[model samples]
Target chain A: MKSARPDSQGHFGPYGGIFVPETLMEPLRELTRVYKVAQKDPAFKKELDYYLREYVGRPSPLWFAQRMTAQLGGPKIYLKREDLNHTGAHKINNVVGQALLARRLGKTRLIAETGAGQHGVATATAAALFGMECTVYMGKVDMERQALNVFRMESLGAKVVAVTAGQQTLKEAINEAMRDWVSNLRNTHYVLGTAFGPHPYPMIVRDFQSVIGKEARKQILKAEGRLPAAVIACVGGGSNAIGIFSAFIKDEGVRLIGVEAGGLGIVPGKHAARFAGGKVGVLQGTKSYVLQDDDGQILLTHSVSAGLDYASVGPEHAMLHDTGRAEYTYIEDADAVAGFDQLAQWEGILPALESSHAIAWVVKNAGQFAKNDIVIINVSGRGDKDVQQIAEWKKGQSTK
Target chain B: MKKTRVDQKFAALKKQGKKGFIAYIGAGDPSLDDTVDIVLRLEEAGVDLVELGLPFSDPLADGRVNQDAAARALEAGATFDGVMNCVAKIRERSQIPLIFYAYLNTLYARGFEKAMNEAAAAGIDGFLILDMPREESGPYRKFISAASLNSIVLITPTTPEERMKQIVKDASGFVYCVSREGVTGVRDSIAEGARGLVGKIKGHTRLPVALGFGIGTPPQAAEAASFADAVVVGSAIVNKFHNNPHTPEGRADAAAFVAEMVKAVKAVNSPL
Candidate 1:
């Protein structure tokens, strides 16, 4: 059966439509047309496959978490090792696909917006490999916090523009990137880093990232001989989650769980959990559950992970939450930190703080599952970028 | 259709054989009182239309000037109802054609139909929603006409010729033709193809075309007015008064600058 989602107009049940300025409309339309053709071309598939295997180190292994499962005394747990991919995250999967699409479209330049800098570094690596000029717009605050990733981006020959507007965060960075795209649309391609934004983007990014789910589906069957009882992933803009969820959506028995950053608590301005505290509103070119005030002004969000500190979640997640097809919960910052420590000690894996939220959810709810039941947790990225911040957190905790 | 103040004002300008001058500023930039005072001053200075920007947290189509102005407005507690109240306060004295230049979410959040009714009641004549293109304007347009408010549409430099027809078909008030291929900000020169774009749009619709975006100075406004039926100056005018003290003298200082732009635009002998 054909999946009837994000219908032709790029809407996912009244969410995810084009809400950008008129100037960018034509360019978006053109990109949509180009991508439609590129998606079906065998040559395009062959090229992307070659790069995924040789360049990005694709088909990231699925490792069974023996130590964590034994310690938690619950379901058998497996980690989808997206953290081991080149550039140390799953972002390169989509970036490599889009960079190839940009080349096919005859575009010579690339631009992207990044929050935690994983996407920025991935995009920069693709641009360097493809020999195209690249620019990344990042918030000034994010630049300060993700300084190593910032340096990594710069070393790959991408110019990182520090946006100082509106809390100096991911939302403002997206606004600045939109401005830059509108100003220079002739030969530039905006490689939107998330499964967000208006039409074509949510679809395009999901299709490229489906590799994660596609691989995990095959690898899990070979190892466990059946579908996992549930799949868990961290929800930032919901890219990595969507990447893994796309393959399991048709599996009626597989439970999909997305963990949002609970930040300090569920209080106003204290968290980035949109489903818990947000309303239906549009922001940054898509209509979704946005953390906004009654006046529709986006509320400032807080999260220990820079990547998850966005006011809006991707539209597909909004649709999923509404349809009750997936389960969404939240983990507080302190709990996520504890989860991070648990993984590094038990599994010997330093999970990204964003992914630690997912691990934290399993830690709290593992007792609800049978011992023979299997679960998959997407290790979306490595924690090298977050080590410094965690050290600061530890120092502050000791002082307090 | 009931004639809005925007329609009447445009008719009066056409009868006078002169182009219109539109000034834009973020509503409640410093305070709601300052916005009311500044709007009346704009009318006195010969501004044919006042586009009060309903500030949004993320205004992607805007440049540094408008973005900062929005920040200041939100910082000063500029809520949606508060901005409409500022419009009502302006209506107490002046009858200048007032249109809200805002992004879509500001209206959609409060319920678009309710916001439209409130705006019409508060004397807003039309809307120039920066992000709501024709593809997404269906529901909003229905509410706009139901409330007797004009749905002002936008055509940009990047808008292809074939797409212009669909954009202007259900449009009212006037067509806002972007002067360049970028966000709203001041530029040293008017884009080369702006006049041609206006001429092309005229081929598709009977509506008056107002060239905006990047037309900051009086000379630039004059240059744009020479080809189009009206000129819109936003960032340059917003930059003038956004930093001034929230007082009558500051309002007058800003109005004086608008008076220069109005004179410049009105002096142009439109080729139309």
Candidate 2:
């Protein structure tokens, strides 16, 4: 069945059109054309499926969090075990797909921009598996906090370039990666880390990630004999959220919820909640809800989770918010930390700080759902990468 | 469409049988007032047109030099209103053709029509939005033409001949032919692909071509002017006086450097 969105020009309603310079227009067009062809090729599908199932370990489990469900005393919570995947995150799913497409496009080198460094590690893994040269741009601040992931990327044989531009965060890293891609368009394929860039990218990344939803939908039906009342995921650039939401979009009875980083509070410069504090504007390459001031200068964003620290959300998320298909809300840093600790102690599973935002929302709103209601939260990644950062945060909190 | 100052200046250059020299400077580099001084100084040094860069938070098409200039501008309190006010002040002294080199978000945030109207009211002659390609320029083109401002289009070395035909269909003012495949920066010598790109654009539209990107030195500017109708020098001039004291001597020194570029471009006599 053909989906009704993106209209060939890659617009989801009024969002997600190409907004890059003339130098990249031709290359983007070529990529779009090539991706369209690859989607229908049987050999392409067989190769991608083989790698995803055999190498990356597809069909991650859907475990019922009985302790959390009993303690919360509201919804029956089910956690999607994406953390069980190879590399301990869901990012490998999209990276492996793009790497295969890159090989098909006849390009050699791979470039990426990372925030918490999960995407960088995933890209590096794929590049090494495929015997391709890889480079990743990461903000200086992120490189300091997510040092382990940075080392992991280097250990995978990827060159990590530290970006020291504005705010020294994900936004600046994306800017640096774009500069590199512009300079090396001939031999390099930019493996965008999120579902937020110009056309074809948002669509391409979302399609690659939809496997999470496809698996969860079937698993829930067999496990519970019905669809979950709500499906929850955290929104960074919204790749995983859109991934799980894509399968349930047409199910009218199923509610989709996306949680954003509320940071310290709703105050300006203290949060990364685009739907809460942002207006519709163009940034990076796509038109979407962006955190900006009155004069359109992109605002600085703050999140305890480096993965969720961004000024803009994906364009499709903007469309979903406007069309009222999904309910969006924010989770503060303190609450997210609480969620992180709660999930570890109660469920015996460590979740990435980014995924804790979704858990935080459910913990804060436990009374909103009925006790029989089934709700699934996507465990996007494991917390092994965030252990030191959270330990330091806890030490500082105790001192305070 | 009515002839804008940009069109008139290009026609005037054609009549004088000399190539045009276009100068680019970030508004409010140190302050908005200093931008006025720079524009007037470049005008006095024989610049036929000026491309005023509107500061954006994330400039994907710019290199380190232009990016740093934007950072300085934003740090010096450069806003949309401040930049328009600077243009109004320049109109108080000179009539040199002026255009905005901007990204789509800066104007889209203020409402494209309202932004264009305000700019035209403040004496901006045209716009060269770096990221708005032909496919996404439908409504933007209408807004520019409705405001009676020239919608300047860019044709890069990577743009194929078939795509170039579609890009220059309704292009006004003059076509900007990028001298290289990369973002805005300085290079050692002119790329051989620039001449072919210009020739291809000429086949599509009668609009005068202005070659930019990496044309920073006087000899490079002269070489670019040998084939194109205009030569745009941005990063070299920006890097030259970027750290000078914001005094009369500083403005004069910047103007002296630009004057050498003007002399080089004007010395190139070629049939258009």
Report the C-alpha lDDT of model 2 over B156-262, residue by residue, as the tens digit: 87788889898888689999998887888999999987888888888889999999999888999999998899999898878876967778998798889899999
Write out the backbone clash pairs for model 2.
none
TM-score of chain A of each: 0.98, 0.98
Please compute the TM-score of chain B alone for each predicted structure, in the order given.
0.97, 0.98
Cα lDDT tens digits, model 2, A178-286, are: 8898888898999997888988899999999999999999999999999988999999999999999999999978899999999999888999999999999999889
Please give the range of 10 consecutive residues that has the lowest summed lDDT in model 1 chain B. B242-251
Give me the overall lDDT of model 2: 0.92
lDDT of each: 0.91, 0.92
Relative to the real complex, the DockQ score for model 2 comes to: 0.81
